[model samples]
Target: MIGETLSEDVLSQLKTILPKYGLEDTELKIIQSYRDSSQLNQQSGFSFQNEAGSKIQEEKIHLLENELRILKDKDHLAQSVAKEINVLFPSVDSFSLGDFLVQNVQDFSSSKEVTVLVKWKHQVGSVERKRLELF
Candidate 1:
């Protein structure tokens, strides 16, 4: 039972759950170790879908989903900022706002005063940093 493999159904359920938890390939190996040690496949009527119905798991899933939504919102904001920068700095040939990495962000007492330190590579293989202000 210990060395036995999980059925396709269980494996499929695991694949769905693992990604929702942000588990990567390395973490999957740890899960495999636990699965092998626990011999979950040998248990009668053991279902990951059923286990996922637990309150704690549901709460964790909800939290992770919220985090993902926030991250997506931030990414959209970044893209919008990039587009705006591209329009504003049209004179800089070969300059892509998306290529700029955010080094630092500072906010002043006034909402209009926002400063961002961005770093990007120049066409001549040099890194350049610029402090941009938003008013």
Candidate 2:
């Protein structure tokens, strides 16, 4: 498992097991980081379904952000734990899922009102369409 990377779905489910290993605080921190990252991501052009998904996204971003911060610290134990986290959630280092939130952006010239268009892409038959939009 250390040589091969973990998939997103697997990482998501495996995250639950970290707590059993007494890494709950570390995991929570990572979730908080992802939440913070998600807030910035919300500024991007995309939409979320219901408040629950939005809330969950925020929490995940926050957790990821906190974990990154803690990992950056010089604590030896924290560093070791961070390595374990990397092994579990391989996607975290690959791309910021938060970036998916802000793939597109539009601005109004007169009002100076920044409209954030959030859309979720879905597959319809043979084509993919953005089904949800939010500003």
Candidate 3:
């Protein structure tokens, strides 16, 4: 959830999304202003029914539109990323690397086992063997 303070990157992304969705810079500014105003109103316990508050409320609608647009873009991006990962390592029924590796009987009985053991030793160093008396 976008808390009281949104990041600069999020605002910049909004700027890019606004134009793509036919929104102007001024429109985005107005939307951001409303967001700020609403935060202030929440703190003050005031009804957003005054003239200025009405404008802010209207801008809130635009902000929701912008949020929805961004979410849709993100959803599409997630799908595309999934497809790319699938294509890169196809022939696996599922996406999990751990599950796939464990299920597949790719020969790891000799050289692969040695390679893994060496890599693990390199990672842990001699300290584990010395401490655990794993001679």
Give the Cα lDDT of each candidate: 0.52, 0.47, 0.52
Q: Rate residue 103 of model 1 by lDDT.
A: 47
Backbone clashes (count) for model 3: 0
Residue 97 CA displacement from its true place in model 3, Å: 16
For each candidate, what TM-score against the reference? Answer: 0.36, 0.21, 0.30
Question: Which digits, one per residue and each the tens of the lDDT, describe model 1 over residues 5-47?
Answer: 5777877777778867777453433133343423654444345
On TM-score, who's better, 1 or 2? 1
Compared with the true structure, model 2 gives a TM-score of 0.21
Report the lDDT tens digits of candidate 3 across residue range 1-135.
Answer: 234566689878877788677676555541233457578567666654789878898999999999899767766765675576456433323322111123335764432111111112134445653543331
Off-target runs (Cα >4 Å) in candidate 2 are 1-48, 75-135
Ordered from best to worst TM-score, the candidate numbers read 1, 3, 2
Better of 1 and 3 by TM-score: 1
Global Cα lDDT for candidate 2: 0.47
- Candidate 3, residue 93: Cα displacement in angstroms equals 7.4
Question: Total clashing residue pairs per candidate?
Answer: 0, 29, 0
